[model samples]
Target: MTQAKATSGFLDQVCWNSDGLVPAIAQDFNTGQVLMLAWMNRESLALTASEGYAVYWSRSRKSLWRKGESSGFQQRVHEMRLDCDGDTVLLLVEQQGGIACHTGRSSCFYQRFSDGGWQVNLPVIQDPEAIYK
Candidate 1:
């Protein structure tokens, strides 16, 4: 679907969990492909909307983070969605500048387990240094 069609939905009804957070999944809008998943509290959500970028709550680091703050491969928010349960969220983004994966791959989903071994599915699309400082 076009971004304009995808963006017409409301973001106010999205249900935040008890901790005031929602699980946000970042997907490639054109391909309907998932790229990454993260959490966002009310502040982060608001920040994302106001800033026109994706802001996430880091469970591991217990902090707020803008995807690619250091890498410069930011995900610009094209549209945001709430699932039927209201517990999950979806973000359609225009990924800027470079690969989203820190491992030098275009995306994080680069591995597939085969019959007896692990296989790399996609190639690293861009060098991290070209975008990251």
Candidate 2:
């Protein structure tokens, strides 16, 4: 079958939220470390499937965000899966540049809950200022 046909079938199964958005999680393909969580609209998800990379809906900007378009931290997807309820997407990817979080951390989930508070347990892999600019 054509790629479009395959993608269409997959997209039909996703249970998008009221805003027509679904939560997408990016995880390390090898280590299974969750890198970040983003949202995807139909267009972004379709683009991701066709392009073989990560594309997310930028809620703040109200636009499609091609991952690594600026910071060069692209996510090359190895596999994509839907949750049991079909409301979430999981992308197993090879994160480029070793940074997944905009803050330059390897993963966005760097804060750990401990001692009745949240603690930063991971060092920044690179300076955000340097990465963005």
Give me the candidate number with maximum TM-score: 2
Best by lDDT: 2
What TM-score does candidate 1 get on C-alpha atoms? Answer: 0.77
TM-scores across all candidates?
0.77, 0.95
Off by over 4 Å in 1: 1-12, 116-118, 126-133
Question: What lDDT would each prediction earn against the true structure?
Answer: 0.77, 0.92
How far residue 80's Cα lies from its native spot in candidate 1, in Å, is 0.5
Candidate 2 Cα RMSD after full superposition onto the native fold (Å): 2.1
Worst 10 residues of 1 by lDDT: 1-10
Residue pairs in collision within model 1:
none
On the 0 to 100 scale, the lDDT of residue 7 in model 2 is: 38
